[model samples]
Target: MVSCVALLGGSYDPVHAGHVALAALFADLLQPDQLRIVPAGDPWQKAPLQADAADRVAMLALAFEAARLPIVIDRQEIERHGPSYTIDTLKNVRATLGPGASLVFLMGADQLMQLDSWRDWHALFDYAHLGVAARPGYSLAAASLPPAVAAEITVRQGSLEQLRTTPSGRIYLAETLAVDISATQIRAALRDDDQASLAACSLIPPVVLDYIQQHHLYKN
Candidate 1:
């Protein structure tokens, strides 16, 4: 059997339950040899992160330490300088896994819609297969996809079997548990200490919450 590695990259300013749940779901679905949870070092497309790189990585480690899942907190993107681009990260991960290993790039449905805007977005398929998780109100079959992306989807889309076996060039849509949580909301709640907001932050793990409180993160 070919070894498969799934890469799920994000700012992970403070890894929350939604992130952990999605990672677990994907791991079960793909049965990859490893599921790497990557923290973005410097995301150019978005506003600057509230927490520092070390802090984000530390929280990620705490969040996944007892996940009972085959997950690893990958710090390559966190360690690298400058903006963190998906294509660049994929290239490095692909090379590390070699040509024989199947590399799966995991993303949410919303990210798929905006993929064309990413730097060298088209080249992403050349390095790894896309494993997109369905999000609320986002339809993978919608007509909003870019022509090139839609074309690639039509041709390269595959079943879980193909996704597990093929080394690259496939798009797999997975229905994962929608936790309806966002890091932005969590940060806002932590900063404001609003009762309602704090309640909504239940999606965050206890250990991670403790770490956040200990470090006084998001309390600007």
Candidate 2:
């Protein structure tokens, strides 16, 4: 069987249950040899992160502690100095994995729609297969994407079998259970001392929530 590595990159400012659930879902669907959760060091496209990198990493470790599969906390992007571009990260991972190992780059349906705007987005397929997770009410069909992305989708889309066997140049859409949770809302709840909101959402892991309270994070 071909060795496979799945990459799921995000800020993970304070890794929540939703993130954990998504990782677990992908692990079951892809069955990669390793699933790496990469935290962004400096995400150029988004606002500045609220928590420090070390704190985020620590929370991620705790959040994924009970995961069914062994999930790795890849700190390469967090340790790097400049902006964290997906293409650069993918290239580095590809080089480390060599040519034979299959690489899967995981993303949400929202990211898929905005993929054309990413830096060197077209070349991403060269290094890893795109595994887009379906989000609630978001369409993964090619017709719904931008012209360039639709064209690529039409040509590079592949089945689960091809994704499992081939090393690269395939786009696979995996259906996942809808977990309507966001780090933004979690942070806001922390800031506002809204236990009701947090409990209602039920997205933050207990350990992670304890860490956040211990560190007094996201109280801005």
Candidate 3:
């Protein structure tokens, strides 16, 4: 049997409740040994992140508390120069875990569809298995993809045992709790009041909200 590791990396500019909720769900469903909230530094493939690594790392520490599952704020990517490629991160994690350690990278359904666009994406499957997050209105069939990559994906029913001793480098669709909150709306609220919902409609936690207030984020 192999020790399972769940890697959840992102540019947590202002870690919100959505992130917190997802982490908890991932821990509960997959029950991995560690849930890593990797703060992305200079990602090579995408545009520069919104906030600096330090700020994002700080916010992540603040968002995650003892109440949440054991989520480690891994800094490997933050310390690395150049792009924060998933493949690089996976390799580092796999090396640390040694052989038989199942590396599972967690992501939302929307991001899963775009996996083919990532740098050395095909190789990522070689390094780690995938945990496709389940969200409302997120259809696996509708996730537009290249025929070749699409054929390679495997959708699971999101069971804890199913993931316990599964094959390496396979994709698992984790059907756990889903919080449909968008950060764009949160940012827009700072500039102009949200027309669709109230200010508290944001999934961001109060502490993050307070920090953003203190720092005057999203303000010109």
- Per-residue lDDT over 85-174 for candidate 1, one digit per residue giving the tens place of the 0 to 100 score: 988988888887788788899888888888889999878888999998887777777476777778878888899888788888899887
Q: Residue 203 in candidate 1 has what lDDT?
A: 79
Local lDDT at 32 for model 3: 78
Q: In model 1, where do residues sit more than 4 Å from their true spots? A: none
lDDT of 1 at 101: 86
Model 3: residues >4 Å from true position, as ranges? 44-46, 142-145, 154-162, 193-201
Candidate 3 worst ten-residue window by lDDT = 154-163
True-structure lDDT of candidate 3 = 0.71
Clashing pairs in 3: 44-83
CA RMSD for every model? Answer: 1.6, 1.7, 3.0
TM-score for each model: 0.94, 0.94, 0.85
TM-score for candidate 3: 0.85
lDDT of the candidates, in the order given: 0.84, 0.84, 0.71
**Model 1 clashing-pair count:** 0
lDDT preference between candidates 1 and 3, better one? 1
Worst 10-residue lDDT window, candidate 1: 173-182
Q: Give the TM-score of candidate 2.
A: 0.94
